[model samples]
Target: MADAATSPYLVLARKYRPRDFTTLVGQDAMVQTLGNAFKQNRIHHAFILTGVRGVGKTTTARILARAFNYEDASGPHPTLDLSVEGEHCRAIIEGRHVDVIEMDAASNTGINDIREIIDSVKYAPSSAPYKVYVIDEVHMLSTAAFNGLLKTLEEPPPYVKFIFATTEIRKVPVTILSRCMRFDLRRITPEIMTAYLQSILDQEAIAFEPEALAMIVRAGEGSARDNLSLLDQAIAHGNGMVSAETVRAMLGLGDRARIIDLFEQLMGGAIGEALDTMRQLYDLGADPQTLVADLCEFTHLVTRMKIVPAAADDVSLTPDERSRGAALAGRLSMRALTRAWQILFKGHEEVARAANGLQAAEMALIRLAYAADLPSPDDLIAKLANQPAPASGPPPAAPLARPSGGGGASALRLEPAPVFAADPAPAPPRAPAPPLAPAPPAARARVG
Candidate 1:
């Protein structure tokens, strides 16, 4: 029988993996730092690139490998010579170089496998000027395997260099860490990752609405790879285009608009509307527990904006989101917002563990809604100060944080209202009174 393999689909994650520093997103600081080192010809003999999965640790290692073995079949590499179009650098990127060897430590974690690398140092490269060995997932190497590799790594030929990449840096031996320069790749920010995905969409001529892109980036959770993979799934589901509805369904996310709508209702103290929105989501076949988690994350994002306005700009939020978020911010007292967030997260745990997730989530949301009416600390302090002191209690101002400008809370830093002094009242003119007659006693006056 003929083999019936399914057609392969290249997910966005793999299809758009950064091929070079220029293509890399959200790692500008690390990229710039590395570029400076390269420009100065201060490259080290060994390097350890550490980061979470899909943040481009292995990719950075490959780039460094190309930087060392770079050449110009068509043009010179991007080294000091700078004569070439950087086209020759393409070969290294394509993994066609003879001198650059990539080893997957997860698959080949044995003393013998490490010994093979050690034995290769005696010979010069067949073509390239330098030989680079990239070991990925380096933390997986056995202790004996690491020891076997260490001896060769410490005293390799001048032309030989090592680049190790790992998601779990803590698991890597400290002795191995000390042998090489290290760079930690950050999780790509939502802003950078969204821009990256949009650029790819434009390149591929895929129609993606802005809201759809935002959803995709949010789903990515700071992993460029994960975002792309999700985009791929979304593209297939939507026939090469992405819309908010299709993406939400594919990701099993509740409609973001619905989520914001519910949040707005909750923030605005319209508990009825919020409950209706929840009912609508349930009717739409959304997993209630997932909805709760997504809402919690949404609240977290908005809360971050309180401390840093740049957070909203830096995150991937639809334009409608900005307006909605601002309105919610206005309605929610900071104290209540904090309490709601805590409750939502705690409820998420409860929902996850409960037999009926919907009930747990509903209860959690209702609790949040109920807590929304509570007054913030500022209002409470103001109320206490203006009210009469209890018969048995000390004064309210004694224990309160009484700012010099008493109208505004000290923590908020708002300027106090101007308090004007009254002009002194004109002295009342002295009133002249008739001299009092000597008053007789009441009984004598009555007798007279």
Candidate 2:
């Protein structure tokens, strides 16, 4: 056996692939279920593993295969505690075990390819306790191939086990899906990915900055394999030291502080300054689409901070992001932040599709800046409701005639009618007017 020090270099992704259930991250539910099933001897003959790319669907399938054929001096029994490699573990993991067969449906998607599997099910295990078949990207199989697989897949020999992996679970027919015990592998969350990457760096004795790890986590987007691959590149790029500046340059990411500043300039309606900042970032190797996405992300962060102040305490955030984001959240209204998000969100797609991404990004920033100055619908409604109604001239004075039998004419002044605003205020309580004097009988008769 070759020692790691003397062997050719292995990529971090391959070097650190999880060898057993215990090492797998962000899949505790599936791991527990499998453990319970194996303990009870209730393991199914056919198991389907489904998840997005890089989330470990194929890796899970391989692990399942290893579990099925696990053997030791105690006895030949299935188990999930693969902490120690069993009799055939090394061969199986190396994909050289005669009893453990691996197939890629992507390259071989036809009835003939599946026919071989159907024919092989009748045979017994060559050495291991169980004959395990691992098929990857199973959704790529042709319709006829799937139909051919249906009968054999439903009822394989007691000594045989089938494990299928697919990225597109929907593409796999319901008939195929219904016949198997399905385990949906979840994407590794950022928190878990961050820890996992740090652990790997520690084992490799590589130095890494926390902010650099955060960038890698963001880029990974919950994919373990992707995160590891990125970590490898960052380690190489930084000459064994992963720094935030190096990761930013490697990923074409803008500085977090500068990104926050850009957000401020846009929200402050400083279009010229924002545009200048964006161009400078682009010249520094930042991607326009990535920059727009950063704006959208910051908008989301500020919005979250506004609604949930506790979000500002997240460890993934840089000190600048936390302080400035919290301040912006306090200063900016929810409506402004939401509107900025919308503009930037739409503009991200435009930048991706545009012939010139920088120009498209500039236009998006301009639109966002101009839109920030426009009052929200609610603001407009409040303003309209608060305005004073139009003033009218003073009410005309009219004569109040005296009774025919009495003295001279009296003048009565009428106040103008009350002017109501768009949203009128509640009327004030009124005191009863004094009773008017009644006209004399002769005055009433003459007026009539």
Candidate 3:
């Protein structure tokens, strides 16, 4: 046995990888279904596991392979309770088990590559109860390869069990998907992820501030592997004691309180203050794109709080976010929040492409600040509707007095003057008299 000091140091991600269903976090639903299936002896011959990266797709595939081949003193039976290492558990987990074959579809995507699997499916397990083939990134397989495996995959021998894992489930054909039991792994929520990380830190005897941990969790964005990897780097950077300042510095993140202040300034139409805050953050090593992304996230949070008041109580949110966010939500209209989100979201991309990220970020902030005072379309429409209508035309002409009639007493009554259409046509031109008319008149007078 190697000395403790001489043993190679493993990163937290691999060191804390879930070994069994009991240890897996944020996948209770899938685990429950599999457990029920195993309990009822209704195991499917093949299964396709799909999810985003770091959600344990490949891990679940391996776990399934182990369960299929699991055996102990009792007998050969597929089970989910992997508490006690079975006869072949160590070898399978170590990935050297002959009967449990693992293949990367990314590297071997050709039809010929799949032909090997087709040819080998007939062979029985050497030591384990079943021949388990685990193909990862199965969506990368060629169309011909998938077609070739269809018939066999649909109806494989009793001794053969197949497990496929892919991040892109849509890329897999419907025919292939129809033939296999599919399990969609979910992203780990922040609450569960936090508990899992805390447990690991406790076991490893590392100290971490809750705020620091929350920052890490936010950075992870609901991915277990990503969180673990970030945790590992954080530990090293913090010198075994994770602090919020160190993590913020490591991630190039602005101060949360300052970010909140900046958001408030932008939404309050204080462009100068917001730009100053932005410059300070930039000088402190905060990436402009990241800063804008953080603002966008805050905008989304405020929007959620406005829509669903319960969102403010989420475990992932800090005290500052809970209180300040609720206040912001109460004061700001949903339209304004949505508009801020749009501007910040677009600004993030602009910052990414700009020659000077800080300048781009400032420009985006200025736009948001100016837009803060602008009324939403709905509000503008409402304002227009509420205003009194303008005078349709010039006020009716002054009342006119009618001339007194033949009655003994004359009376005047108010009446509106007549109105005419604009631009009346001109009268037709008169014709000229002929000169011969004058000569006829003179002849009549002299000789008639």
Candidate 4:
């Protein structure tokens, strides 16, 4: 179906596209490098910016274009005014400037197109001092087009500048690349992506739980554009408040709440309950790989809690998730949690790549359930050392805690568990008082 109102909402992606060098995310190395070069007036005549899809390659090009074409009343050009915003900057953004031209080489791949560009370069800009030719997907230009433009590219008019951008730098010939200064834009990091998304959500007056924002960040992979696209849908899909539940449904993720329950059952060695939870999720149309992935994140949160208990207060968790996580942490040991994480991660890979992902997932869950009951290598060794040789009738319900020569375990105990009715570690029985004959006799005499 077509969109309800095409023009009503400008997505967080396009709406918040970086307007200047400072706004670019997770490209600090490139931004600082370019900023320093511009300050030193060491910029080259031709340049290339390379990166993956939606990683701000074109945006960077636009920023460079404005920087090069920019001129102040003092007549220094972008060399003096590097800011990519203003009245003239708006024109540059809208692609209306006489000097700044943006070409999509994908559609205009031919010799004549190159010739037309070549012809225009001989004459300097009619208005702006530098004529910037931004060819997007420059790798798409035909052999003839590249050949035709080679001479001008090697040595264009003093005022003509070329800025090429490509998703695949390997496609462009070495001869073409050697003439330009190249900067490879990098994919944004999850932390940077999360912070940026939070800012956008805040400005929109949208209420989003931190975990929901992290989901969007992870979903983006590395592209600010992709994250914004997801954010757009998330904003529209929710009641203007993005929450974990909304993000999960939007991304086709398993319900985290249910996933957590399944995880708890796995930790507690309840295989039947874990499988039942999986079926319930499956009935709700949850993908197995997604469910595993959500579990991966849940494991990560628990691991974080292990490392820095205070991190439980981190914004990435919804309030309820934080509370639940605290409870889960309190109940489980770090070693067991880490082991579960490893098994689930491996299972996710197997399930994701399998022909029958659901079956793979079910099998994976069973494997995890088995892993939950098995002892770690360390524990296995300890048990073997202390095993009651060949027990006959119904082995003890649970193993006893180890102590040094009957002394209670203490050094390794970070925090003691709370007291309960059937607590396994009973308080050491109090020793009987020494025969109280002397003290008792004195007390009896005083009573008499």
TM-score for each candidate, following the candidate numbering: 0.76, 0.84, 0.86, 0.69
* Residue 238 displacement in candidate 2 (angstroms): 0.7
* lDDT for model 1: 0.79
lDDT of 2 by residue, 83-109 (tens): 888999999888899988899999999
What is the per-residue lDDT of model 3 for residues 32-148, given as tens digits with 9 covering 90 to 100?
999999999999998999988898887787788888888899988889989998988889888899998999999999999999999998888888899998999999999999999
Off by over 4 Å in 3: 376-422, 425-448
Instruction: Put the candidates in TM-score order, highest first.
Output: 3, 2, 1, 4
* Least accurate 10 contiguous residues by lDDT in model 2: 407-416
What is the Å distance of residue 314 in model 1 from its true position?
Answer: 3.7
Per TM-score, the best of the predicted structures is: 3
lDDT of 4: 0.82
Superposing all C-alpha atoms, what RMSD in Å does each candidate have to the true structure? 18.4, 13.5, 11.3, 21.7
CA lDDT of each prediction against the hidden true structure: 0.79, 0.90, 0.90, 0.82
lDDT by residue for model 1 (1-448), tens: 2333565656566666666677777788877777888888887889998887778887777767766766666543435333243544566777777788899999999999988888887898877778889999999999999888777777789889899999899999988988888888888887788878888889889998888888888777788778878888888999988998898888778887788888777766687888889988988878888888878877876787676666666557877667777666665556767787898899999999999988888888888887787777788999999997677633333234666866765444344456578999999999999897876799678989
TM-score of 4: 0.69
What is the alpha-carbon lDDT for the whole of candidate 2?
0.90
How well does candidate 2 match the true structure in TM-score terms?
0.84
